[model samples]
Target: MAIKMGTGDLAKYPFLNEAGDYLRQSGFDWEELDRPDTREILERAEERLRTAVAGNVYEKLDRYETEILTFVVTLIMVKSIGLDPVLKKYALAEARRAEKFLSEDLRRQSDAQRRALFIKIFEDLFGLKIDVTEDGRLFKVRVTDYLRRSSHFHEQEWKMINRLVQAGQVFLDADETVRLIRNELAILIINKVRGMSLPTLPNSLVERVEQMRAELTPRFEYRTQVVTEYPPCIKHALDVMNRGENLPHSARLMLATYMLAIGKPVDTIVEIFKNAPDFNERITRYQVEHLAGSKGSRTKYSVPSCEKLRAENLCFATAECDGIVNPLQFGKKRANKK
Candidate 1:
């Protein structure tokens, strides 16, 4: 038998089966969403959508039931709006929110409880089994499972070669384990939302859905034209992002820095990321500005050298890249020849 989660647990992770069971057992009907008594739920749902749009976590209500219901209503609202970007954004935000609570839960539980909870959560929710080392200081996951989940991570540190593995199992600390599952959780939520069949929303809820659509829609005016002067690596990164695929963090940093080095406006660089699968305008804008030296440390960052990029597997070197140590130097020789 699977370990059952309490209402509080369900509230933290409303995507759990227990939360869905709870809502169904409560006899809550879709028509009730427009009732005056359910206005609080509707309002909370709207707030959840807005918070996600702004790239922030939605706060949980004092009542666990309210939290669970609000999550359901939020999903209904997101599904009714039927915008792909909004669905992706909400799924990402909800997953992050769950991660925050999960991290807190793991830290607060005693060692024995933490181990059991961690194992149970992974096994039950993700069908992935996790084990604690004999000393209980490290978590162990099968190499195959690690490879599947770690594919979502683009950092060099997540590469299998960099991991501590023995006897077909990869070793990771508690925090790292949690971080590895964040994308899985997001994907799960997205799948669930996509599978839902929502009824025609009441007028009140329809109006709110329209409001959410207006707010979450991308309104960027910048059109991306291929800059022939850009090196292959930068162009590849832009192509990945334009196709709405996830770009590796190193590539994103390189692209941002290289663009900034060539005097591209911060807004233009930020707009370039609008088509990213996980794009959050607020977070992207902040990061682009930071790279531009307008935020944190206020020190302009430079594009990584070709050698560093190659080491990180981010390089797409061609004959044109010859003798160019950094991406900024890619088109210089050609310009000089002209």
Candidate 2:
């Protein structure tokens, strides 16, 4: 594959990693697939869509690029009949790409190859797995057989198969799979560009992407005010973790669970821990997902109480910590006061 540098206004996006640039240069852009960017794109798309209640200005974007823009807006933007034309247009385009990508050899390809390709494209574009459902027994069994024979299979892959037991079956045929994957890629690309303000582009062109982004992105109030509500112990743990200090397992769990309980998205929680002394994206994602009830027992963890933190010697009491047992209680008290 040819490796190309990031281009257009996407290179300026604040949260994109070097990997995203590399992938884009290689002709597959998975930009804005991260939690922050995805949220931003959704926000922008929503705002732009609302402003243009009448019609879009319709700048001429590349067919593939436009399809991606349209998908992100339609998918993330609020669910309404207003976006049906844009959604159908890009969805059909993505479907065509999916058909071409799958070709006639889909049946002939080994299940392992199919599984591998499916996983790679999804991960490459969205940094996410296409969840396998209980209905996908044939697909799951084939993938499991392949993993059993492959030494490269690790705990993450193992967990994916486990998740397959519960996820909804979305892949009906090879073409459908391709179409879905392509649609996601389009969203990823749009997320990268539209999530970040388009620098140096003509207002008309930028508006086009933003309009699409607005259509797909949803509206939500910013949670910036939540910082003041953090309990002293959880706040301390976060500060120490951010400084690359080694935290006890209990401390880590408390922080992770506390953040999750506060309605912080999994991605945001994971990003907060990225600065920890031993941060591994795969391991971190698995652990966070596990705590957030996306994996394993599906039981969302609660933050440890003052008593538990004291037991672990992870407690850092301050004036704000007075009489507080659990972090959630602390937050609730503050909210109730307001």
Candidate 3:
């Protein structure tokens, strides 16, 4: 496959030529591009688009050279034309390539500079939440809208912002994006803040997106954070629940008892059981509430001990769990020291 450019190319198809030129200058391998397996290339290309949307754009482009810019443009273009899966697959490959260049350019910046750019981009995408004391407005409506929409913020992207909250760190069983959104909502709680300051993308990257708009047009499933601190028994239960598998009576009791101990609300705990095949909200609520001490003896239940769990065939020990008797104490060994 060969790439054609210049005035004749411009006349044939209009796109951001400058961006294309930059990519063309970098070059690609012709032999690799000349593949006999069109099906494999198409499948891989589609995989690239899915990966790009999920924030793996840079990693996916470690090999491909021709498909990057074209992918982004194609993705935008497909948003208008009804998306054919074939077009979408090719577009995804292109996006990976474009993102590779963007990532490299970003990598060159000083750490602080890069952070400032990310903050700016986030603010531009989602405006600051105004403080009540500062001449107030319909901020609630604005915040509601933001929370309703999806954000580009990912869990891995929160390292810097997480540091700003405190010198020390605390881990919660929620996504970093969820934590960031909650931070934004903190204004409602504190009633003293003006807004959250998140990093934004660099101007060059933003410019590329804007250029696409002027030129053409286009465009979890519960994705909570992995609770690494969870005990093997609890982890097994959660994994089973996620897969729509049933938990035995004892297993359900253990999970409910543990989640309640961790301070998860009754309603939230109820939602967790909603994925079960025999899920009944009324029954789940009664059972959860009963375990939480609202019924019978009014005594909140506790998670089973490792020995008990082992007897029940629910225990699946990890190397970290050795010497721990109680599931509650599994990940807290270090915290217990502090």
Candidate 4:
């Protein structure tokens, strides 16, 4: 059996060249000669249009198709403006990427599709925003309407502008195109912002995003810093636990009291309850607020309060002197590290 391959010299054809007709209708001034790259670009672009045509007429799409449309426009631009050799010989198939964002009922697309495609081609790829002119009189065009109705472009008008953008990317850093391309993106977004939902963000979202990128991306440097998190109340309770060599749940309450007495927030005291079997912020607050004064008898001026602080005689002295420092301050203070 012989295999069939499709290769034929087609200077002669049974049908007229469809691409040639569209070019003529659009008013392009070409040499009337077939160039290889131009033919390829146009053929591919028409194919994209054909694919679009076959989908459901009433279907609606919210796809971000900016890249696909941009690719096609780049093709046209390259032919109009000529190639740039600065791209190394080992470069990939294409030096730039483009897309067109649009949403619409597919059934009515035929009426305004061309104009929509044109506007996106020029505005999105060139970094131009859809806004009033500097004079403040021109009304901004909606990208969605223009895309659905094909309103921004007319038949044959976009070919030159498409070429200009493509030519620039081929010779310059393709990533730079992102800046030029997104200028108009916000205009389309403002209409939908209120109803938009985005992925979850962090408390320091912007900085965290930068941090992650810096750590994960190629050629980024990273640094480390130490931070002190302990406060005076916490430190006092912690010291008690450490002195005993082992802190228990009863002892934890003592730490909580210390924290409360020093005016630590109830929520902060609650946070210290990792091992607190019966931790309650309200109870801890009550206990820490008032230290027993002289066992209900001695006043500050009546007896030798702190100066005559006898270890065995006083009932309201430090826990080391037998006052029982809350009950949990018995074990070693737990170590925490960053």
Per-residue CA lDDT of model 1 for 1-338, tens digit only, reads: 55667888889988888788998899988778778998898888888888876667887658899889999889888887777766777888898888888777776677777766776667777878888777767788999999988876768889998999999999988788788788788889989989999876777788888876676555422235575667999888877765555687888999999889988899888878876656778889999999888999999888899999988878888999868888888878777989
For candidate 3, the per-residue lDDT at 72 reads: 31
**Candidate 2 vs. true structure, TM-score:** 0.33
Q: Taking the tens digit of each residue's C-alpha lDDT, what string does model 3 give over 1-338?
A: 12333332221122234334654675633233234542343344345434533323324333333344333333433342222322322333333333333244334545544334334322332353311111221112133333343232223333233422222322222122223343332222122111222224333334443553443223212223255669878888888777644476778988899899889999989878755534556778999999999976888888788888776667889887867998888877766777
Pairs with backbone N, CA or C atoms under 3 Å apart (clashes), candidate 1: none
Question: Looking at model 1, how many pairs of residues clash?
Answer: 0
RMSD of 3: 19.8
For residues 262-338, could you state the per-residue lDDT of candidate 2 as single tens digits?
78898888777654433455777899999999998998877777887775566777766547777677756555678
Off by over 4 Å in 3: 1-225, 336-338
**Best model number under lDDT:** 1
- Best TM-score goes to which candidate? 1
- Where is model 3 poorest over a 10-residue stretch in terms of lDDT? 130-139
Q: TM-score for each prediction? A: 0.87, 0.33, 0.34, 0.15
The lDDT, on a scale of 0 to 1, for candidate 2 is 0.48
> What order do you get sorting by TM-score, best first?
1, 3, 2, 4
Q: Provide the lowest-lDDT 10-residue window in model 4.
A: 6-15
